[model samples]
Target: MSTAIDIAALDPASRDAGAVAHYGDPVREQRLLEEGVGLVDRSHRTVIAVPGDDRLSWLHSLTTQHLEKLRPGQGTELLVLSPHGHVEHHAMVTDDGTTTWLDTEPGNGDLLVYLERMRFMMRVEPVDVTADWAVLSLVGPGTDDALKSLGVDEELDEPDTLDVPGAKFAQGTQPPRPSTIYRVASLGDKSATVAKFGAGWVRRVGNGADLLVPRAEKDRIDIPRAGLWAYEAVRVAARRPRYGFETDHRTLPAEAGFTAPAVHLEKGCYRGQETVARVHHLGRPPRKLVLLHLDGIATDELPAPGTPITLNERAVGFVGTAVRHHELGQVALALVKNNVKDDAQLRIGESTAQIDS
Candidate 1:
């Protein structure tokens, strides 16, 4: 039997700075990710802790999601939108009774600044805990088995009810709601917290969980490791939109397919509620996010992000993230004009892409 590899001992070439890009074989990593639980190091992501008697109410007034009644151990996502309804920042939020923990993509200093400025007379205090805390994800059908191996046997509560009003633009089937947070008494002698979120494309790739543990204890957890390459492949295949990858300064919640889970339409007045309500009630967004299957591209020859997607030499949209999937050949997520036909054959450089049905 092959022994479990320690991710901390990986060669420098296999990692991009601190994040593991791959483990010498991206295809094999992707296969392992699809077939069983693959441990992904997400320590580079940012973690913010908001502690106060007024944390929930203060957050409810500033963000797009309804959070005034957020119960402890309940997890959900929220978006910070510009006054014009443009997505500014996004975060995965959960409360642990005393403190509300929010994990988001790195480079979210602006989000912290905004939160500070919004605390007029509120009793909330938001602090950056990224340096002390680290995030790890267990992704695949075998997540429970892997957790069992680590001596974690906590039972998760059912997800909170997500019923809210004014979700008309949240078309198609909504993805699963975020999982309840569970406290793990020990993960190899280290205490940690686990929750299920969209870590591995929760819609298509279910049975995923995230571990929030102290940075010092991350290297001690023994498990087979996968890299960000495998995580991105599964994310792209699931048609899930990420913050930096699928969103830009001009992105609306509905445009990037975030209206369902990230936006609580019937909530009381918030920063960008007017625009979100107008767009939802009036007409379709200017652009729509879609998954595209790139034809005939080698693993090493995939197009870089921001590559222009065209139709008949006319630029229509741009690519976000591209990856080589284990089942699907080459696939990418793109934001195209809403008027673009569903059957339209688009081009990214010389490669032709068909919108995945």
Candidate 2:
């Protein structure tokens, strides 16, 4: 991590979930991300390769999203659920004709194991490919323009030439909403730069495009380095729920607000489809996801995850994630009772919070 970030002149390293935190001036970084292009190191993400004749179909049957119409260059999310409809694993999936790539959070060995065990009688094979590939993200309003300046367009296509041998790239998300996904055999080589591969693959996400590249080539990429701090700020303002933090082993798609992005209500039978449907049609989830607007000046430290949230002096929910947004200061994502009124005031570890939903 140091080797890649060192070249970008980022300092005061902090760690978030075992991934390097950022460079410096998170506020400035986020400002740039909202107005111009900024780079964020995403080496901590894990990648999986599903290769076989039935790869697409098999995965479609197992995940929350429909995969039959997922064309090359198109990217969307997938959620692996327990039989009871709890979100167990989440992945961002993309297919490039021969192989379908699943990019997920760190420590995906368990997810891989679970997936491999379900491959009975199918030709699909899931392999952990994080060791071979790396990831980086580009954010900001100007990100898409910057990639176009380098030659890669919004169209997903393999460049005839590349800086690294056997390198191919498609569009996807590493920052939840990303611009591209690059696949390369090796990263030890020094000459493998993002610019050498038609700059990068570009896709449109919210206001910017995210670029994915090999970990070793992160320093080689020419984008300005932004850190996790900036990423968090933008994500919170966007009201996006993270996997392990906001959605977890006990989280249902409805509770995490993933009913649209990650769940297909009309998709065919899946492990937790019954519960998902039942919850949508018959009953409400025990809890519902909400965004919180802390009613005070921003503090040096934000509310910690799992901090108890109280309503009328009684615990009603807990904090999941929080960020001091560049625009909306001291924002957080929380889970509260489905019965909690939107206008109700709450408390998070003594800080008064109100539903921002």
For each candidate, what is the lDDT?
Answer: 0.74, 0.69
- How many clashes show up per model? 0, 2
- Alpha carbon lDDT of residue 235, candidate 1? 84
Choose the strongest candidate by lDDT. Answer: 1
Candidate 1, residue 294: how far the Cα is off, in Å: 1.2
lDDT of 1 at 61: 88
Tell me the tens digit of each residue's lDDT in model 2 across 28-67.
7789888888877776778888889898788878987777
How well is each residue in 1-357 modelled by candidate 1, as lDDT tens digits? 133343345534322236777767778888888888888888888889999999998988898877777766566788998999999999887776678888888657788999999999999999999998887888887887776665556544333435433535455332233322232223323233233221111111144777777787676667788888888899898888988778777889989988766787667788889999888886688999999988745345777667898999999988888888888988999999998998998888877899987
Residue 164 in candidate 1 has what lDDT?
A: 35
Residue 307's lDDT within candidate 2 is: 79
Clashes of 1: 0
- Which residue pairs in candidate 2 have backbone atoms (N, alpha carbon, C) closer than 3 angstroms, thus clashing? 134-215, 179-210
